[model samples]
Target: MTAVGKQIREAILATGPISIAQYMQLSLTSPVGGYYTHGQVFGRTGDFVTSPEISQMFGEIMAIWYILHWEMMGRPTKTRFVELGPGRGTLMDDMLRAAKRFPQFFATIQGVEFVERSPELRRVQMEKLGCPKESMESVKDKNEPDTPGSAVSERYGGISVRWHTQLEEVSVESDCVPMVMAHEFFDALPIYKFEKGTSGWSEVLVDVDDSTTTPAPPQTTSARLAGSPHSSASDNSSECHFKFVRSRSVTSNAAVILRDPRFDSRFDKGDHVEVSAESARVMAVLADWVSQNNGLALIVDYGQDWTQGDTFRGIRKHKFANPLSQPGSMDLTADVDFSYLRLAAQGKAKCFGPVEQGKFLLDMGIQARLKQLLQATTDKKVQQDLVDCYKRLTDPNSMGRIYKVLAVLPNGAQGMPIPFAPPSKEELNRPKVEKIVRK
Candidate 1:
C-alpha cells in the first residue's frame, strides 16, 4: 500500500467513514503524501496524458481563438491571459508563441497567470515557463493577487507568468480584461457522489470492510454480489478490505445539496449522481469576473452535457484502477457535467457551446493547421506521429466525441465567439450533424 493509503485507512479507522470528496481531496492534496503534491503527473510518462501534451497544435489553435475573440471584445490595451491547472506550462508556451503573429494582442498581454496549488507541479511549471523571480507570495483570498509585479519570466519568450493557488487570487485592475483557459481541468476537481436511497440521496463514503473474508465492493453495485465484478473481490483472501458505503451526512464541510431539477425524483433506489461544487464555485467566480470586467473563459474537458451513474475512476500508469484501492499513487477523475457549469453561469455570464471538442477544434480550423504542418514536415515518422495525434484528438471513438468545450462570455455581449456561434436558420432547420451536444 502507498504511504497515503495507510494515512487514509488510519483516518477512516479513527473516524467512522469519510466522504468521497474528502478522500479525493486528501489523496490529491495532502501536503506530505498527496499525488499531485509530490511529483510530475502529465505527458506520456505520467499516469495520463492531456490534449496539450498530445500536440502543440491544441494550444496554438486556442491562441488563435483568443485573438479572434479579443478583437470582438475591442482588444483592450491590457489583457490578462490566465490558465487554470497549467501542466508543465506547455499550452501557455505554445499560446504565447502563436500569439506573436498578432503583435498587438501579444504585446497587450499584461500577465499570464496560472492557478495551481501543487508545489511539485508548480516547480515543473516554472521550469518550462520560467522560474519565479522571488519566493511565491501567499494570498489571503481570491480577490487579491499575491503582489503586483510578482511574475515568472518565460524561458523562451520575454513574457512573465504569475502563479495563484485559487481563482480568487487572480486579480486585475477594475477595467482590465481576463481571458481564462481551463483544459481538462474541471474533471480533476473533487466531486461528491450520492446514491438515491429508499429515503433520499446520501453521500458516498469510503470505509473499512469487515463484512467477510472476501474483498469488498470497490464502487459498482455489482461488486456487492456473490459474484463480484471487481477482480480483487474474487480473491476472498484478505482479512480486511476497503469498500464504498453510503452515509447519511458528510463529515467534510465541502459537501453541498445538489439542486438540479432534471434529477428531481428521476432515479429509483440505488441510482447515482456526481456533484462538483468546486467546479461550480470556480465557474461562478470566473463567470462573475467576465461579466464584470469583460472577457471569456474557455473550458475543455471529457464529459457529458449532463451526467448520471458512477463516472468516478482512477488511473495508475495509464490503465484503469479501482478508485478506492490506492491513494496518492494515481489520479482520480470524474466526468464533468457541462450543463451544471452552464447553470452556474446563468445571470452572471453568457454561456456558449459545451460543444464536442472535436467539433470545436474543427470549427476553429484545426484541419487547416494540421495540413500546414504535414506539408512542412518531411520525415515519415514525424508525419505518422502527427496523424496519430490528430486522430486521437478528432476521432469520435477517442477524445473527439468524448471531450467537450465550453465558452463563457460577458452577459449581453453583441456578437458570438468563433467555433461557438449559432448556426444559420436554414442550417439549423436541416438534419443536424450531431457533432456536439449544446445546452
Candidate 2:
C-alpha cells in the first residue's frame, strides 16, 4: 500500500469512516503526497488537459466575452480579472494576450489576481504570467491597503498581479469592477453522497474494504495546507482498497441539504443525491461579492442543472479510473449541480446559462475566430491541430454538450452578457418574416 493509503487507513481506523468530501480534500491537497503539491499535473505529461491548454482560441473568446461585459458594466477604469484555481495560469495568459489587441479593454485591466493555494502552482503561475521571481512576496501595496497578501508584480505587460490563498484575501474595491472566472473549479470542492432509504436519506462514507488485503503500516505523512490534514502525495497505488458504507440513519448533512426549500425540488427524482456544501457556500459568497461590487462571474464546467445519477469518479492520465482503488493516485470529481448553484445565488445575484458550451461558443463567434486562425496559418499540421481542438471543444458529442457555462451578475441588472443576452427586435422578428415570405 502507498503511504497515503496507509495514513488514510490509520486515520479511518482511529476514527470510524470519513465522508467523501474529506477523502477528496486529503487526496488532492495533502502536502505529504498531495496531487497539486509535489509536481506538474497539466498538459501532455500531466493528468488532464483543460480548455485553455487545448487552444489559445478558448482564452481569446473568453477575452471577447469579458470585453463585452466590461462595456455592459459601464467600462470601469480599474477592472480586475480574477481566476480561481488557475492552473499554470494558461487561461489567464491567453485571455490577457487577446485583450491586448483591444487597447481599451487591455488598458482597463488594473491587475490580475489568482486564488490558488498550492505554493508550487503559485510559482508556476508567476513564471507563466511573467511575474519575476524577485517580485516582492507579501509586499504591501500602498494603493490596496487592505490586501496584506497582495504582491505588486511588474509582469504581464506592467499590470500589477497578486496571488492569494483565499478569495477574502484579495480585497474588493468600491470603484473598481471585478470580473472573475472559475473554469473547471467547483468540481474539486468536496461533495457528500446521500442515498434514499426506507425512512430518510443516509450519507455515504468511505471505509476499509474487508475483502481487500490490508497489510501495510502507516507512514509519516505531511500537511498539505495549514488547516488540512494530509497523507503522502507520493502514496498513490492505483488500486482502490476502500469500500462505501452508508449511515443507517439520516445524517445532519442530509437533513439540511435535502431540506433546503430553494433546492428541495432538485432532489425529488434522484435516488442518490450528491451535495457539495462547499460549492454552495462558495457560490453564495460569490453572489454577495458580485451584487455588492457590481461584478460578473463566469463558471465553466461539465455538469447538469439537476442530476439523478451518480457522477463521482476518478481520473488518471485522462482515462477513467476507480475512485476508491488508489486513494491519491487519481483525481476525484463529480458533475456540478448547477441547479444548486443557481439556488445558492437565487436572492443575491442574477444567473444566466447553464448554457451548452457549443451554443455559447458559437454564439460568441468561435467559428469566425477559427476561420481567421485557419486562414492565417498555412502549415497543414497546425491548421489540422487547431481544427481538431475546435471540434473537441464545440462538438456536441465531445465537450460541447457535456461542458456547460454559467454566469452571475449583480442583482437589478439591466443588460445581459453576450450570447445569453436577449435578442434584438430585428432578431426576434426575423423568423416570422421569413415564414410569411415562404407561405
Candidate 3:
C-alpha cells in the first residue's frame, strides 16, 4: 500500500469511513505524499496533458479573447491577469508572449497572478515563466496554513505578478480589474457524490473493507460481515483495500445542496448526483468579483451543461482507472457542471457561453490564426505538427465536442465578446472539411 493509502486507512479506522470529498481532498492535496504535492501531473510525460501543452494556439487565442474583453471594459489600466491552477504556467507564458502584438492591451497590463496549490508545479511554473527566486514573498493563508507553495511571487516572463493560495486572497475591489482564466480548474475541486436510495439521497463514502475480526468504524451503515464480522482489513489481509458504502452520517451536505435552488432536484430513486460545494463557492467569488470590479472571467474545461452524473472517476497515464483503487497514484476528476456554475453566477455577473469549444474557437477566428501559422512556417514537419494540433483542438471528435467555454463579465459590460455572439448565416452554413482552415 502507498504511504498516503496507509495514512487514509488508519484515518478511517480511527474515525470512520470518509466522504468522497474528504478522500479526494486528502488524496490530491494532503501535503504528505499527496498527488499534486509531489509528482508530474501534466504534459505528455505526465499522467495527462492539458490544452495549453497541446499547442501554443490555445493560449494565443485566449490572449486575443482577453484583449477584446479588456477593450469592452474600456481598456482598463493596471488590470491583473489571474490564472487558477496554471499548470507549469504554459498558458500564461504563451498569452504574455502572444499578446505583445497588441501594444495597448499589452502595455496597460499591470501584473499577472497565479493561483496554484502544488509546490512542485509552482517551482516548474516559476522556472518556465522566468520568475527569479529572489522576488518571493511568503504568505500564510488560514485555509492552507501548512503549504510551502502558498507564497506570492513577483514577475512572470517580465510581467509583474504574485502567486496566491486562494481566490479570496486577491482583492477584487481594487482600482484595477481582474481578468481571470480557469482552464480545467473546476473539475479538480472535490465533489460530493449522493446516491438516491429507498430512504432518500445518501452521500457515498470510502470505507475500509471488512475482512477481519476488528471493530468497525463509526458512521458505517452496518457491522462487518467478513472474517468473524468484526475483524479489521489490516489484520486479515496484507493488501490495503477500500470499498464504497452508502453514507448515513448526521452531517451530510446533501440535504442543504438539495434544498438550495443552486442544485437541480430532479433525481429519481437509485440516481446519483455529484455536487461540488467548492466549485460553487469559487463561482460565487468570481461572480462577485467581476460584478464589483467590472472584470472578466473565462472558464474552459471538458464538461456539459449539467448532463453527466457519477463522473467521479480516475485517470492514470491518460486512461480510465477505478477512482477508489489507488488514492494518490492517479488523477481523480469529475465533469465540470457548467449549468450549476451558470446558476451559481446568476444575478451577479452576466454569464455567456457554456458553448462547445469547437464552435467557440471556430467563431473566434481560430481558423484565421491557423492559416497565418501555416503560411509562416515552411518546415514540413513543424507545419504538420501544427496542423495536427489544430485538428485535435478544433475537431468534433476530439476536444471540440467534449470541452466547453464559459465567460463571466460585469453586468454593465458593453457588448458581447466574440464567438459567444449568434453565428452568422455564412458561419451556420459552412461545409465541414478536415485540414482546411475555415474563415
- The global C-alpha lDDT for each of the candidates, from Candidate 1 onward, is 0.74, 0.76, 0.74
Model 3 deviation from native, Cα RMSD in Å? 9.8
User: Which candidate gets the maximum TM-score versus the true structure?
Assistant: 2
Worst 10 residues of 1 by lDDT: 221-230
Evaluated at residue 117, the lDDT of candidate 1 is 83
Q: How many backbone clashes does candidate 2 have?
A: 12
lDDT of 2 by residue, 1-439 (tens): 6566777788899998888988888888876676676548876567667788888989999989999888777778889998998988899989988988999888878898899877777777777877665564643557543332444445556787788877777766788888899998998898999876657678899998867553332222111110111222333345557888998788777888778653343343336767898999999998988888888889998877774346677656655556776666766778788978998999999998788888899999999999999999899999999998898788876678868899999998876677886546874564321011111
**Can you tell me which runs of candidate 3 are displaced by over 4 Å?**
138-157, 210-240, 248-251, 261-265, 422-439
Q: What TM-score number comes out for model 1?
A: 0.85
Q: Give the C-alpha lDDT of model 3.
A: 0.74
lDDT for 324 (candidate 2): 73
Score residue 281 of candidate 2 by CA lDDT: 95
Clashing pairs in 1: 142-168, 142-169
Best by lDDT: 2
Cand. 2 TM to true fold: 0.85
Q: Write the per-residue lDDT of candidate 3 for residues 1-439, one digit (tens) a residue.
A: 7777888999999998888888999888887778887647877766677778888999999998988877766777767788999988899889988877887787777777788878677778776777666554444566654333433333333566667788877764378878899998998899888776777778888898756433322211101111111222222212327778887742447888667653345555666677888999999998988788778889998876763455676655555455666578867788788878988898888888778888888877888888999999899998998888887788776678778899998888767777687656884575421121213
lDDT over C-alpha atoms for residue 288 of model 2 = 87
lDDT (Cα, tens digit) per residue for candidate 1, span 1-439: 6677788889999977887878899888886588887657776677677788888889999999989887887778888888898877889878887987788887888778888887566667766666554644444456445332234565434556677788887778776788899987888898888876675567787897656544442443211111111223222222334688877643334234555555554555666778888888988998998888777889998877765557787665555566776578777888888878888888999988778888888988999999999999999999998988887787776678878888898897876778776756874575421122213
TM-score for each predicted model, relative to the true structure: 0.85, 0.85, 0.84
Task: For each candidate in turn, give its C-alpha RMSD to the true structure in angstroms.
Answer: 6.6, 9.4, 9.8
